[model samples]
Target chain A: MARLVVLGGGVAGHTAATFAAKWLGKEHEVVVVTPNSKWNWIPSNIWVGVGQMKKEEVVFELAPVYKKAGVIYKQAKAVSLNPEGKDTSDKPFVTIEYTQEGKVGESEDVEYDYLINATGPKLNFDATPGLGDGSGQMGTNTVSVCTAEHAVHASHELEKCIQKMKDGERQKILVGTGHGTCTCQGAAFEYIFNVEHELKKAGVRDMADIKWISNESFLGDFGMGGLHMKVGGYVVSSKIFAESLYAERNVEWLIGAHTSKVEEGKIEYELLDGTTGEETFDFAMLLPPFSGVGLKAYAKDGSDITESIFAPNGFMKVDANYDAGAYENWKASDWPKTYQSPAYKNIFAAGIAFAPPHLMSKPMQSPNGTPINPTPPRTGMPSGIIGKAVAHTVCDLITQGEGAHLHEASMAEMGAACVASAGKGLFTGTAAAMTVYPVVPDYDKYPGTGRDTKYTFGEVGLAGHWIKHVLHHMFLYKAKLKPGWALIPE
Target chain B: MSIEEENFQKNDNFKLTMLPGAFAKRMRTCVVWQFIRFMVLNIKMLIVVSKSH
Candidate 1:
């Protein structure tokens, strides 16, 4: 029986492995190798960071779930890939180091007939000085909500800041990107507003000076170049929507910023205008930029073939048009449909692990030649869609034979619904629910805004907040592989 | 026209508002309307996911 091994158990990897296991049944083996024992519903991390939800509420043990699904689960991190096998054997395998209890640092080589590299971003806190120590972890100075543990810590720190505010101390809050190239501006945006909402509820809003600093050229860019949103009655740009939110909530902003360094209570940053400055904060939540979780590849003869498989950013090279150059020249066809590796027919990549053809935003550089633009956002929706699509292709290849055509799920052709929470109240809180048809805007399909106006829509209000709450439960239930889980579309 | 409702102008790009089954796409700020809109939008989102690929 052919073995299908998947690296990483994040949203994309877990979905692919689970769906593949169900589709292939007992005929083929499906193995999942990931570092974390718990599967994190990352979108709920915003609520956890603000102390509205417990860490356990956003995460669950993955071992039991995978066991129930009849899939082999390895709590380990992949170190390297040997697609052509080792010198001792011709069977292609991957070297994985165990991170589970009592087996830390222990390793094993497991061979596979087909492999899916869904090892999502490395967090790369080291990309910005003081965001982390030179080592690959978050530093002590600032807080992050990228993980369930980090969210709990951030919530504790925010509580301390709130207590200080209650003592009549004016706490300065800074929330935004840690580096220029960071994605997930929506998460950061959600966090800053959540903090604001919490402080207001605590009756210390007047004393707290909350500020947002991001790499987006304009507010509301949220990495997808700021679509035209239908707010109120008029069709204003997302920049306008975000600005109104900030203004109405009494929060301030500093856009076009790239955080350069972080200290105990201060941060140094460079703006797109080529000016450098420093800001002090009592509480800060800075998101680290993401890169591929570096995995090396070797030939059977012990030759390093890492460069042939991965992009410069360490992301696995897929069927995308990596050579697609310049912002003005990018086409909808630049995006990959099948996500299959060009060199290895048995290799595929999904989620953030795959290198995108280009940034969705109009790429820009600082006056001093430093690139300062938000990366394209592949949020939970697109990631899950890509995962399901990849699983479909792989299943077809195995069951329907090798000549079967692969299923396609291109970002340029698929729609995504992103509901960004602003506060966590059942009826009082607010959120912005946006639906963009074809996550990657097709300039050729629709002129001017490059999006189909009828299909692209958003609104911010209490109703949006309620939708966000429902989604939190719906997605978690779906991810746990509950009954009728497949009914929940990607 | 009242100053509060006067802020809402005609010719909004989206004829559909956040509330499902609500014909009015104009600005709504009343607590009563907000409650109605909440239920409507929640139902709409369910349909959105069900109908979406």
Candidate 2:
């Protein structure tokens, strides 16, 4: 049987494995290797951080779901790839170390006819001093909402801070990216406002001070360099929209900032204007930057060919123009359409596993030579869409033979809808719902803003919170492989 | 004022803040208005999702 192995089971890997299994049926083998046993619907983790939802609400067991889909699921972390096998064999295999209950640390090599690398980000917390425990995990000084467990911890910390506020002791709260290269500023943005709302609900609004710090050169640059949204019959930049929200809610901000260090109750940061400062807080929730999970590759002679197959950052090399140097020379066409590795046709990468050609934001560096800019965000809607497209191509290759046409889902051609929650109450809650077309702006196609403002829009209200809540349940249901799940759009 | 507050004040963001009017703020949570908005917003999102495929 033609075996297909998908590494990592986040949004991308899960979608690819499940769809490929259904399409290939009993004719082919589909194996999914993921370190975790549970599937987490990440967006809802923000709600979990505010105690609006529990950890169990955002995550579900992956074993049962895979079983129901007639797919083999291996609870293991992928270590390396031997794409050229050994000197005696031409077949390819991936080495995986089991993290499963009974087989913890047990290593095995599984041969594959095709491979998909969707290992996602390593959550490189150690990129900044004191941001990590030095063992590749979050540090003790601050909390995180990146995972369901992290959100649970963050919720408890927030509760303690609120209790201190209730006792008439003032507290300062800070939330944003921990490192300059961090993505997912949206999560931190949602969290700070939620904390503010909860403090007010607890009758301690005056006792708490909240502030935002991000790597974005300006506010609302949720990495695709910010888009112009048509709001109230006028096209307004996200910078204005975001500033309005922050100002209205009495939340202050620090932009063009790279959080350089984290210590007990204080953080040192460097700004774009070559200035450095320190901010102190009683509570902090800062996200870490992402890197590849460090999967190595070897050739037939067992010589390391990792550099040929993956980027320097550890993400797999895909069908994109990597040499597109200089910001002024960048083009939308530089984005990968098929997501297939150029050197090996049988290998592919989806989601954050594939390295992008360059930064979507205008690259900037401090006078001290420290790079402080937000990296591209390859999560949520775009990740799912790319996953499904790659799955389609894999299935076609198996069924329609070697001449099968590849499917494409380039970020440059994709439209994304983001509903960023501000707070969570049925009537009192608020959120900003935004839509952007052609996420990677094409200057030649749409001149000024590089986006079609007609298809791009945003608004904020109680209605948005309801939609965000609805999506939480809808996405979970789809991930659970419920009946008619395919009918739900990615 | 604190140095941080002054740092924020020096920026031109204050001039661009679009604080909704009293009527607009009331409409944001008005059951009827929000219900209509809920439907319209979903339709808009569906359009975006459709074009993406």
Candidate 3:
């Protein structure tokens, strides 16, 4: 029987492993290797960061779920990949170091017939100065909601700031892009608003000065450029919507900024227009840039095929047209259809682990040659879609045969629904529920915005917030492998 | 519905704003015309103010 090995157990990896195990059944083995024993619903970690949710509320033990799914689960981190196996065999094997129980640091090589590398992102906080200390954890200075544990810590720090504010001490709050090339601006944007919401709820908003700083040339440019949203029966660009939101909320902003360094209580920043400045803050929630988990690969001859296996940014190279240069020249066809790696037919990448052909923004560089543009973001909807698509392709190759036709799901052809909460409320709060067709722009189909304007609109009200709250629980329930879980989309 | 329809339904009073580049050349001609008018007005104003002085 062929063995299908999946790496990491994030949204993409878990979806791939669960679907592959169900489809392949007992005929083929499905193995999942991840460093964490608990699966975290990362989106809810934002709530955790704001003290609105508990850590346990967002994370659950993965062992029982994997057991129920009939998939072998190994709590280990993949060290490296030998796509060409060892000198003795042509079969591919992955080397993993265990992180569970007493077998910590113990290594093993698991052979695989097909592999899905949905390892997600490395949370490369160390890429920026003082962000981290190279241990894959956030630094002691600033806080992040990237993980549940980090969110918990950030919440604690926030509580301390709140207490200080209660004692009549004014606190300066800064939130947004930590690095110039950071992609997940949406998360940061959500976080800043959440913090604002929480502070206002605590009655200490008057004592806090909250500000946003980002690499986006304009506000609301959530990686896929700014989209036009139909709000209140009026078609307005996200730029205008975001501007109005910031103005109405009294949250000041500085766009086109590149955070250069982080010191105690302050951060050094440079703007796209070549101006340098420093912002001091009592509390900061800066989102770090993401990178591949730094997993290396070697060829049969031991020659480093690292370049062949991965993009320059360390994300796995898939079937995308990497040479599709220039923003104006980019087409929807540039995205990969099958997600199969060009180097190895049996290997595939999904979610943030897959290297996008190009940035989504109108590629712009600073006068000093600093490439300051929003990196292509493969957020929740796209990550789950790609994961399921990869699973389908893998199952077809295993069950039907090697020549089985692969399924196609391009980011440029799919639609994504995002519910961004302005504040949590039943009837008193607000959220922006937006739907954008083809998360990536398809210039050939929709010339100007590259999005179907009809499908791309946002409505802000109490109902939108309710949708976000429901999505949080629904996604977690699906991740837990509970009853009727299959009914949920990947 | 098409994007135009969705947009129109969302905001009945909203006017479509074209990209700045599309009318840049035409806008330059208008700017020249406005500049001549401003110059003539200023010259006339100067003459009136000088006579009053």
- How are the candidates ranked when ordered by TM-score, highest leading? 2, 1, 3
- Best-to-worst ranking by DockQ: 2, 1, 3
Evaluated with lDDT, which candidate comes out highest? 2
Report every candidate's CA lDDT: 0.85, 0.90, 0.81
Winner on DockQ (1 vs 2): 2
Of 1 and 2, which scores higher on lDDT?
Answer: 2
Residue-by-residue lDDT tens digits, candidate 3, A61-132:
999999999999999999888999889998999999999999999999999999999889988888788877
Give the per-residue lDDT digits (tens) of candidate 1, residues A1-490. 8899999899899999999999999999999999999999998999999999999999999999999999999999999999999888999999999999999999999899889999999999999999998889999999999999999999999999999999999999999999999999999988998999899899999898888999999988889888875555566677777775665556678888989899999999998989999999999999999998889999999999999999989999999998888888998889989999998888999999999999998897789987889998886888888888898888888888889898888888877778887778776677777777667888898667767656667776666777788788988998899999988777
Q: Which candidate, 1 or 3, has the higher DockQ?
A: 1
lDDT of 2 by residue, A48-69 (tens): 9988889999999999999998
Model 2 chain A poorest 10 in a row by lDDT:
A419-428
Displacement of residue A191 (Cα, Å) in model 3 is: 1.1
Worst 10 residues of 3 chain A by lDDT: A422-431
Tens-digit per-residue lDDT, B1-53, candidate 1? 53223222321311122222223323233456767867766555455444334
* Residue A164 lDDT in candidate 3: 98
* Candidate 1 vs. true structure, TM-score: 0.93
